[model samples]
Target: MSCLKQTVNVNKAELMKNYIKKIFAMLGILLFKVQGQIEDRTLPTFATYPKRLKINLPRNIANPQHIYIGDNVKFGPGCFLLALTEYPTSKMRNSEFNKATQKFNPVIKIGDNVTATAYVQISALERITIEDDVMFASNVFVGDHQHGYQSAATPYKYQPIWKINPITIKKGCWIGQNVIVMPGVTIGECSIIGANSLVNKDIPPKCIAVGSPATVIKKWDDQSQIWIKS
Candidate 1:
């Protein structure tokens, strides 16, 4: 009788351990399903979901449908792409908002083979076009709108008017770290913008520009086949 009781106790212990294992397995599968659903929500917005288009998590993409990305575009963590469809009210227009709004459809079109590092922000109020093979270093900001600060007495944040313009970064451009590409600016093809530069005006093609209000320091002379000082 004693032997029989000991056998029954051992069997009960084994059964309990198996039951706990099964519960944990089910929980893991449930968590995986939930995560998959979250990732799938962003898929419908893409124009074409090409293979190997990697985007790290924790990205802030507002109006993803209005933002079209081409093939082989990789975005690092903390990248924010804002494409606003309507005019933003005062309550919605602020640094925290990263707003982009226009009378027409505001679009952000990024071409193929583009790589944007961490904390790269592209805010399109009217339109912002980035051509193929463009690389943006960390903390690069591209915006196509500026706040109207004509009123001295009014607080800058409360200024109702948003000056909307369009920005275009042409093909084969490399924007260095902490560069701010402002409104109405067109960065010409194959241009290299230096770090900590502010691009307020249009940059000519095949030039190396650097400074607060970036000026062309050197330009490629096609005839000479070399970079000449500007």
Candidate 2:
């Protein structure tokens, strides 16, 4: 009788252990569902979001009203896009005077089918227009303004001027990794900018540019149907 009782107790303990494990498993599933819901809520729905737009988490968008993104745009993690409606006077020397005089209503218009990888930073103080089918690799910086220095005595950070000319990236351009497109520069259509290049001037269409202050290395020849060295 004692042996039977011991066997019954062992069976009950095993059943309870399994019941406890089942409870813990259910709790884990519930936690996962709640986490998914929280992540879904964090994605911002813009007023002008186009069809099939997929943006990963941790995207920083400043002045969302001034920024416009077109259809089928995909942004990877750590993308920082800033379209300043007003100039950042705190960074300038004549803060109060510049704030009163300057009218900085910047616009960042990203055209359709654009893909930007991780850590792409676009600072538009005046205007940064990215045309259709542009691809930006990781750590690409496109800014329309730079810190200015009016006098030799003054520091560069003290004078910040928004460039009058905008930064325009024409259609079907592929900007490589760690490329910096500076103010008043225009990247022409179907151009491929090599990795780690700094674009300080205008790049013409259908060419391959490389290096710091990128120079045209090759150009597409329509007559020969090949890329000729520039």
Candidate 3:
């Protein structure tokens, strides 16, 4: 009788342990789903669409369709893409004062496999192009125009003179977090821009640039397959 009672107690404990383990496993799965695990949620279905170019997730808005997205472009949540045509009503007048191009609005051409994180803003009064396999980190701003300083005193309601230009980010470029690409700048192919850098000039291909006014700190070598200090 004593032996039977001990056996029964052990069996019950084992069953309870199994139940707790199952419950924990279920909670773990639920947490992953809520955290945007693509395999567990709606993301995979959305990603499956072959024509789904330039996907802007929640918190993102586009006023103008200046975006010409080719295949495999993924825009993370909170990314904003706008054209001069879609400039905020309050800001449009300011932009026109320094207008650089006769072009009514600029164009943004995003090529294949471009990935951008949250709070990325790409604006153009002239063309801004991102070529294949470009990756942009959080809070990156790419603009091809600036309000003309000469028109600072102009009424906010009046058109401000704009100095529009072009920005081209070529293939395989990885822009680090919080980097700002200013007007008329070209980030050459296979280059990297370090965090918090302000790019005001052309960056040569296969180099790494960092600084307030970006300066190349390293150049990539094809033979060595490494980035060496320049």
Candidate 4:
């Protein structure tokens, strides 16, 4: 009788241990599910969301609330998009953008099917609009404002950023690698800017531009259906 009682007690203890292990396993599963949901957390603070916005790595994106993006947009790694609300200056900052309310205003607007590859930077103080199907290669820099250098004694960083002009890149434009689109520039539709081009002025439609200031080297002649050397 003593031996039977000891066996029963041992069996009950083993059952309890198995029950505890099951409970721990269930808790672990629940925790993993919750962690997965957290990983897929998309910030609701965005003003809008495209049906498919694939961002490999969001880097140096300041004030994304004002950045408007269209459908099927993909941002590659090391892409920097900054719509400046407040400058780095202690005294002079946000004079025109949001002086009274200091709010997030729309600045960088990217249209549908736009892709900016690795290390593409878009810094806009006023506005920068990229139309549909615009492709930007690696290391492309587009900005609408430049740092003030009026005061010789003061450092450039300390000075305010003045809006040069709003930049507009029209639809179906391909900006190659190492291209720099400066302030007040407008790139026309279906234009191909060559690599290492510095575009400071307007580029006509269906033209192939290259070199600094982006001179139009070849213009597409729709009449002859051939490219004419400009």
Candidate 5:
């Protein structure tokens, strides 16, 4: 018995599709490596970073010496951290008068294991502290002071800064996207602030707050191991 050999046909479209996928995959890896190199150059400016800190490029970091970062703190792209030394308030009205005092005294202390996704801006005129294990979503703005709207005629940028109060976020808190945390606000431990919320007031520990002006919607009941209406 004689056996006949059958000719096999290869699909060109399938081969092209796989080749394209591989090209894209390689490009993605190369892009990330370049990004990592760029990000590393910005690390030296920080007051203290014990190797575990990660940050994406295009970071608007000013006075980074005052911005103390802890281990395992990862910041995504567009992370703007400014420890503002000069914000003209009533106390700092006279340049000559305030010169004797701390000419540049601004602090932004971020604890270990804190993570911010993208576009998280933390600007401190006095102090803005984020405790350990805190998570921040994109576009989260935390400021210890606001620019004075003393005169509508004058642009807000030209006006002096008012309400120079320190802000703090306790450990294990999750700050949602587009959340604007204003001056003197302290979010208690393990609390969750909802997206697009304006945190103008202090939120108690273990509470879920939401809205334009964030209000407590639910409270964690340790006894029942459930979240109850606040």
Candidate 6:
């Protein structure tokens, strides 16, 4: 009788342990699902511009709320403009272990009467200024910096390093589809960049540039009103 009672008690304990494990597994699954939903359905906050501005932006992800838009600025569908600031100045000076404060300054200053087509990505790491009467076609990426490629003895997280440069586009410029403007590049006034052009160098005013490493193909003589091919 004593042996039977001990056996029953051991079986009951094992069953209880298995039940607790099942409960923990179910709770973990529920927590994971809830966390995923929260991440997947996150929304962005944007500053309110004027109602006269015609825009068709559909991205509700994490974007800055302090965006300034002009009255006649038109944005097509699937346009992403993200402005984020990092590495506080106070933290860098106050903490001895902390790295230098490298703030990510993203400025999108669009002038009046500008048209931005679908799928344009403008990620300004420092400063991105677009002047008046400019047009951006679909799939244009204009970024200010490439993330640091340096190798360190410790993990990358412990050592905070970054590289950033400013990008500027002057007035009356037209950028065609699939154009990429790298860091520290300036597009001079009234210039045109053709489709699928990678702009790594500075382009002068009143000129047309195309190809992977873009070169000046034609320049408009404003006074003479003729195209000069170079």
Alpha-carbon TM-score of each model against the true structure: 0.74, 0.76, 0.71, 0.75, 0.85, 0.66
Worst 10 residues of 4 by lDDT: 97-106
**CA-RMSD of model 2:** 5.7
Who wins the lDDT comparison? 5
| Candidate 1 per-residue C-alpha lDDT over 1-230 given as tens digits, one digit per residue, 9 for 90 to 100 | 99999999999999999999999999999987876566545544654555556566668787777887888888887888888665555445667546355354788999899998889999886899999999999999999987678878756654544768999999999999999999999999999999999999999999999999999999999999999999
Collision count for each candidate, in order: 0, 0, 9, 0, 0, 0
> What lDDT does the true structure give each of the candidates?
0.85, 0.85, 0.77, 0.84, 0.87, 0.74
Q: Give a tens-digit lDDT track for model 4, residues 60-133.
A: 77788888989998878788888877666346544443333223244899999999888999988788999999
Tens digits of lDDT, candidate 2, 72-119: 988887899887665444454374344343457888999999999889
Worst 10 residues of 2 by lDDT: 92-101
Clashing pairs in 4: none
Runs of candidate 2 with Cα error greater than 4 angstroms are: 1-40, 43-47, 89-102, 151-155
Candidate 3 Cα outliers beyond 4 Å, as residue runs: 1-56, 86-103, 155-161
Tens digits of per-residue lDDT for model 5, 187-212: 99999999999999999999999998
Error of 2 at 68 (Å): 1.4
- What is the Cα-based lDDT of residue 84 in candidate 2? 66
Stretches of model 6 off by over 4 angstroms after superposition: 1-48, 60-66, 87-102, 152-161
Q: List the residue pairs that clash in candidate 1.
A: none
Give the per-residue lDDT of model 6 (tens digit) for 142-203.
87766554666544543543556777788999999999998889999999999999999899
What digit string (tens of lDDT, one per residue) describes model 3 on residues 91-117?
353444553333356577888889987
Residue 191, candidate 5: C-alpha displacement in angstroms: 0.4
